[model samples]
Target chain A: MSDRDLIIDRYKDLLKTYLKGKSETALYKGQQFSRKLIEQQISPDDVLSDHVSVLHELFPDMSEELKDSFDFLLEVMIGYGFAYREHQSLRTRQRQLESEIEVAASMQQTLLMSDVPTVDGLDIGVKSVPAKKMNGDYFNFVKDHKSVSIAVADIIGKGIPAALCMSMIKYAMDSLPEQRMQPNLLLENLNRVVEQNVHPNMFITMLYGLYDTDLHEFYYAGAGHEPGFFYRASEDRFEDMFAKGLVLGVSRQTRYKEYQLRVNLGDMIILLSDGVTECRTSKGFIERDEIVDLIRAHMHKPAQEVVESVFNELERLQEFELRDDFTLIILKRKV
Target chain B: MNIQSCVEVCNEWDIVSARQLGRNMAKELGFGNVDQARITTAISELARNIYLYAGNGKICIEAAEKMGKRGLKIIATDNGPGIKDIRKVMEDGYTTSGGLGAGLPGVKRLMDEFMIDSVVGSGTEIIATKWLR
Candidate 1:
């Protein structure tokens, strides 16, 4: 037989073995055959034809079904080779998206206040849990020698956009002049800042308070925030501090309502986002009485314990996972 | 294919048992591997929602024959104050609390069928299903 015919005959035998189980050897032999054919100036089509003719001649006992199966295998191999490349590209894209999300979540963490500010005559504690990696709800406290300000705000949405809005709020709050001590003025200024920067569809609910230790007074304003709960230990009852206002970014002219309370000894002030009162329970829903009970049970404990107990009870009632972000801040006055 | 299963626990860590039960039900209903993952994620979302939002709630997994194929159903019922606005809850990025508001909406996107019934000052019931082809 001629050299070309010899090469084809050897390749056909290797192909049969490769199909049977010796895939590696078959692949090596096929590569060798192609290199030899290329050196001899043989076209790929001619090499394929020679391979088929040699296979038929050598396997005269092979059935038509076997020939069809070989053809199918060849098609599958070629298709799979392309599919493997496409799969790799898709995996790279998915990884890129995941990394982007991770970066966004990290940035969100920076936007949140890492530690509550320390101030005299105040025992303040705050806790937050994100349903996702990042949260749009945030609470921050800034204090100087004269006054202590506590700010709690919930951005209207979640994810990167809400996170961005949260950051904007934080920056604006940090940049505000110390003279902006009144909660209503602070909220009005924040509203203008948010309305100028945030998306029109998005809004924020904020509760800003300024407490003066020397004067023993607390002044607060609500910009569509939930009514905070005040446990006046002297009265042995919980009273709702209801202050109403339009949500920030809803309208530039929105008016925030300001309220004042005497900061008496042994009184506890609780400010929470919707995540607390909106908490669900197995029996049906969490009512104000249940919340009071939870507080009363742990009120005698440390401020941190009270915060943890509220979360613990909420977890017990749901007996499942949290659906939204949960944030709570507790401020207690020492007797 | 009427199939129902339930698990009860007092602690938050026990949530995993509930997740496994739901995943098993989805698998037994003939859901593919991908379908199983989706269902498991949805179940986790709802279960977490119950634990975090409602405090304590029951999870119910049911399988029914729908569109001539076995369908796995999950219902997370909670006596929480329920959602004040279903539309806002469904809206992407809209969260009453903080966090990335992806719980209910994420579950809605993952399942083949989704339904939410919530009454303010009442409770919330979420039903989601996936069909095995």
Candidate 2:
């Protein structure tokens, strides 16, 4: 065959591969071949002329009207190429995004699912569940020379924004000066940072407490967080260690007030987010007393068992679906 | 705001999670799309190292500030076998695990700050930071 026939043969193979796989790589290869054809000084009309001659040679009895449709075929192929390319890119972008969220969730899991610290005479058990891929609940522990600072923060929103808000809380808390390990002081510092960076509409409730191992004393503060429950094993009575303060990011000048608790042997300090206490019952929202009662029943069990039992109760109450992030932590001094 | 850090490691899932956390954070810090992609890629590389070399490790993603500039920081810590030759690993396309050999060196190029510490038998730690523009 002539040189022109060889060129058409190469073109035919390229088009066949593209049609078979519909791969972007193959499409671009076909494009490169077209470019080379042009560089050899072959015009589009000349290619068309050769195509027609080849068609006629193959189909000698073909009518003129049927022979002229290659132009229309070429036009359709061009449109298909653009649409197919766009669709492939979109699919790739979506896959990348899905994996990104998965990765973020994994990091959140690793961060939140850390092993509960094994203090010499204390038992710690915690559980957290996110209503979505991005959790709005966060818990962390910071240790000083003689004491440990524990914090549980809840962002008021859901999804990505809420998740990001939790990270902000973490960084701001991590950046605080060690000299200000007091609950109220740490909350105040975190408040300033959140108030500066976060929008007014989004607020965060946080409970921060410092436990002095030597003194067996716990100083805690609440920033519009849920009232903490403390069981007095001596009196067989439950005490609500609630403090007054505005939530973070609501006001720049808000100051959290700290409260003191002398943790005794077998005393349990239970902290939770609204997702647990606000679990809707048949009548309405479950009250704080129910959670306290449950903890009181499980007072003799391990800290982890208590948290697990409470979670099971919450899920039973909210059988439809969780509407918020769930977090529950129990710190018990076991003498 | 309340803040604290969590340190734990599981499997390759953690690596993917670290990369995603870094990418989302880069966006939250107002990083451009290009920078976000770069941060995600870098985290994946570092996290993959943890998965491949250490068997299991923890990856931490945090927002950091220096002077007035804000950025994202990622730390991958593992108790896996340490690299015998740091200089060789830093060279592109030099991998011991039959990987693309782009793990550490590519991560170094993608981030604004990169530091690594490793022992002979204890483990390896790679820390990378990318500042948002």
Candidate 3:
């Protein structure tokens, strides 16, 4: 017998046993038979139709109203079957897409991974977390004998596209060592690359800075990125280091303005994404001053602890639900 | 021929039903495979926006004709928290939901003509049309 016929026969036998004695064993068998029916891909309509047929065969005088009700239930089951199959297919497709994105997200992590290099005169601490599986924020460090270059970039898109764009930026930065030291020149070159390769609808905001150990100064440039903060230990004040430049991919001829800051002893320079400054809470956004004060409260700690504390405070205010990708880098002059 | 169908947008299933209705209507109107897919996708995004942002809304698809050309029209209406900055939402890469940031702009690009009317306190309405070439 075909599988369908076999399932129907088994179901009919179970029904007969249950009607004969109303035994618990028969009900248990019925449950087991239902599992078989499910495994055999039996439709509810088919089961109902078979049940009505079996009941008529056993009674030979099933009531007309009861038969009509079975027919109505079968009709409803047919509609339910179609919707059930559609939902299953949609669920399968969603699972496939989710797995693909998960794979891509892991690959992004492995490929664009950068080690936070230990500089001789600076204590560096960095943390980046994605609000989703795929991150729109990217940060990298390129270290050499004379300087350590830091780049923080945020894509205007999300998901696989943004992750792919960030990977491209990482590879591009890796291939270019000539423009690594000059912040303005590096951004100008990266902007051209982004303009040429990235989609027209997408753009990126980036901040590139290089700290020269010999001169004890930081040369920084921006491309519509969130401004960083400068903490002067001698003055015991914080200043927002704003730079004027257009976002990448907007224009090929865009020029990034470069600025330099002399790093006094025990001073700190902070680089971050808008996700840090715009951390949303139930009250509203966490203000820049609040973030600065949070940093001040933990300034006595090590660089890593300070970075972690600031992130912890902001994350707590948002109840640990990140609305955007968070990236923060703190470079404190230790030597 | 004039046919109008409206699908309530309350959950993910409603988005699927709205897209299915759009696809069937496009087929009945003799729209080719490409235009049918575009119309279906546009409806899916619009319906999803309603489900995601407005919580519950409705999608209306109708057979349209203008200037002697056959066309299809889609209207998405929502009474939830309306969009505050319509212009900013229309811009590509602008999203409050942390999506790919291509919701409204992507729909506008898919349809030949798109119009959005939104009031912060009241609600939002979007009408999009695509003509058969």
Best by DockQ: 3
lDDT (Cα, tens digit) per residue for candidate 3, span A106-174: 988888878999889899888888989988899998888888899999998666688889989998888
Estimate the overall C-alpha local distance difference test score of candidate 1.
0.76
Q: For each candidate in the order shown, give its overall lDDT on alpha carbons.
A: 0.76, 0.77, 0.86
What stretches of model 3 exceed 4 Å from their correct place? A1-62, B1-133
lDDT of 2 by residue, B20-122 (tens): 6776777788975445656776777777777777788787888888887888888888888888889888865566765442467667766799999999799
- For each candidate, what TM-score against the reference? 0.55, 0.52, 0.63
RMSD of 1: 22.8
RMSD of each: 22.8, 22.9, 15.3
The DockQ for candidate 2, computed on C-alphas, is 0.01
Task: Give the winner by lDDT.
Answer: 3
Superposed Cα deviation of residue B49, candidate 1 (Å): 45
- Kindly report which residue stretches of model 2 are placed more than 4 angstroms away from their true locations once superposed: A1-96, A111-115, B1-133
Point out the worst 10-residue segment of candidate 3 chain A by lDDT: A78-87
- What is candidate 2's lDDT per residue for A1-335, written digit by digit as tens? 98767998877667667767999999899788878875675644345555555566656899767754754454333333323333444456689889999999888777654456767778998888888888998888766567777888888888889887777777777688663567898888888898899988999999998899889999998999987788888898888878799998887789778899999998888888888888887878888888888887776888999899888877877885888889999999987
Ten-residue region with minimum lDDT total, candidate 1 chain A? A75-84
**After aligning candidate 1 to the native by TM-score, how far in Å is the CA of A304 from where it should be?**
1.5
Q: Go through the candidates in order and give each one's DockQ.
A: 0.01, 0.01, 0.02
lDDT of 1 by residue, A159-243 (tens): 6677778888888988887535889888988899988888899999999998887886889999988778888878888999788
